[model samples]
Target: MIVKKRRRPLPLTVLSTTFVLLWVLMAAFPFIWTVWGSFKVEQDFFSRDSWWFAIEGPRTIAQTGSAFTGDGYYGAWVLRDFFSSVVNTIIVTVSVVVISLTFGTLGGYALARSGYRYTFWLLMLALVFRAMPHITLVSGYLLPFFEMNIWGHLPTAIIVLVAINQPFTLWMLHSFFLSIPKDLDESAMVDGCSRFQAFRMVVIPVMWPGVITTGLFSFLLAYNDFAVTAMLLSQPNQTMVPKIASFLGTIQQEGNVMFAVAAVVSATAPLFVLVMFFQRQIVSGLTAGAVKG
Candidate 1:
């Protein structure tokens, strides 16, 4: 085979590449700075004297005999009981995602497949509910929860998160189901599978990308929620977001800001990992779901 010299890249391509690189740097700079500062003493990181203190970490070296230290992580994770918050966050978010997905899948599939006029109205109702301010809903729930003495618990937060997230899941999954041909469900039934079996065995497999996409959104809703979690859960039951806020509340205390910074990095890392891992599925699901009206 004869080899030919490659053509020169277009100027537009070069300009676009430069813009993208600059955008990435700008987006990443805060997290990068925070991560670097998380290891240094508060004074060094938040130096009024010079920005160079953050880079050199003179105080960090003097205090810990090293340029870097894990003191903030240790303090947050151990002394501040941030690990408990992590556990609570896991419990709340996992429960929210699971419950939301379970109901969302079943309900979404039903709504998508139904021929009845009520389905449209039901979705509209759900949209209305979703559109309402979350705080108002939480306020309404407070009276019931307080009466039932179920306030300030992990399950309370989980319940509210699920309620808040369910409408979104239903809408998204319903769109996904609509994008899929109805023939798949019918074909599975024709193959001697019951409707439920068709859904569980065949339809769900094909819908896996959408499910993952919806589940991740539900996970993030619960994971990043502050207003609901803070109001519903007590101090001991608090999750990472509220816990981090509580750390900031103690900003008057020495080194507490670092604790908050460490907690932020800890909480945010999982979301970055999740998005990176499921980015392809998210894009594919969105594209597929877009095929429908």
Candidate 2:
């Protein structure tokens, strides 16, 4: 009986695994260190004696008789009213997702269905706008927003975010719509349903995977935006990202760096939860649009 030899793993596979491991470590270490330090007092965390002071939190042990404490969280959340920023961020993210998805679905379906000569040009124009730096667009809005006296309001920021985010939204949803067969809607139409009814009854249900993925991108844009929110929103109306930036300025003076650290951890928790729950949809949506029937 002749036995076949087992093949060894390729060098490229080993290298790729190593690279991925290193990248994950690099990305995860900062957040892990920040969370570890958040439980420490300022002195222990920033001490020159040893970086291990942060890990051990000796000062926290001496004061609270525990190596960890909730002071940082309490200070940032209760005293600093970080909840308000959280609320603002949630509102902006939800509003942007809803508005962007609504408009993007209708506009993208139209572009995908239409045989007009201008459709290609329209898509290219959207691509150009999407590629342009958002800051440039923010500048033009400043004057108009100031004139209308709507600068620094949540509604104004929501509207601007919707506008800035639309180009990418249209492009992504348009591609997803292209992957779907036009015959699907036509079949529904042949069954005595109107165009809108066909779309509502047949297409929308199948379109959700793409929509969820697109909405995730929209949420990230609105949630992670600091430049637009900082420039356009008033102090009270600021979102979590800008609020985090503001913490850096006063943390040193206040001698409460851990508060900022805690706030950073708090802010990151939601995104982690979001990914954990919807990662499957995100993957499916991305891959589904790449192939066409």
Candidate 3:
């Protein structure tokens, strides 16, 4: 059967569509402009005379003998060694996600299945920690890190990021675990499986979506994190965000902020691809968490 909906008033429909289109253009214009400008020299992209210089690119043509140039990408990737920061980011984010999920899954499952009064208090404590500013938490670690001589390293950044992100993971996975019924675990246990075995075999497979969701969020936390990474890691060990930031500061002095622009575009591209690849899993995971069986 076909379903029909009431039509909106002409003025309201036009207004809504116009608003949406305007919002999309507003959101996309900066990135579209950045992508176009990344190929141009500073003078053309940041044209003082007319914006048409960006389109015509006379300077770019004069310098590179063509309208566009790969100088910025070459400068950042090859000359500046941006690939090291990319490697560091991958290591930190992957470590954070794996460690967070290892603990979060077990802790969340136990908390969700427990019948103790302390569970509520424990969750509230985690929530309070999660609600606190990340800088404050990072500040607390600085003194000890400096004393231990483990400050300014990739592992330190990963450890701090996990500490900051763990509470949120526990909370989210705890809710996801709650949405799962006890019968699955109980049935598995009755079939001669132990609790850990049931969790590994029966419960976890059904909770896979939730795990992916939590892991993705954990990945994003460590991936985009600036405070912990910047403050803890040394100059040689910076991640993508801080490295891009360093480009903004240093490239400005070199009179070619396009390096920073190029780096920004490079860093953002992977995140776009990652989200698209996980889109279905993310939606399903969110839906599973929201609805109870």
Which model scores highest in TM-score? 3
Write the residue-wise lDDT of candidate 2 on 256-288 in tens digits: 687888899999988889889999977765665
Global Cα lDDT for candidate 1: 0.89
Candidate-wise lDDT, in order: 0.89, 0.87, 0.87
| Worst 10 contiguous positions by lDDT, candidate 3 | 284-293
Deviation from native of the Cα of residue 191 in model 1, angstroms: 4.6
List clashing residue pairs in candidate 3: none
**Per-prediction TM-score, please?**
0.91, 0.91, 0.93
List pairs with backbone clashes in candidate 2.
none
TM-score, predicted candidate 1 vs. hidden true structure: 0.91
TM-score of 2: 0.91
Segments in model 1 whose C-alpha atoms lie over 4 Å from true places: 1-15, 285-293
TM-score attained by model 3: 0.93
> How much lDDT does candidate 3 score?
0.87
Off by over 4 Å in 2: 1-6, 9-17, 284-293
Candidate 1 C-alpha lDDT tens digits along 84-137: 999998888889999999999999999999999999999999889889888888
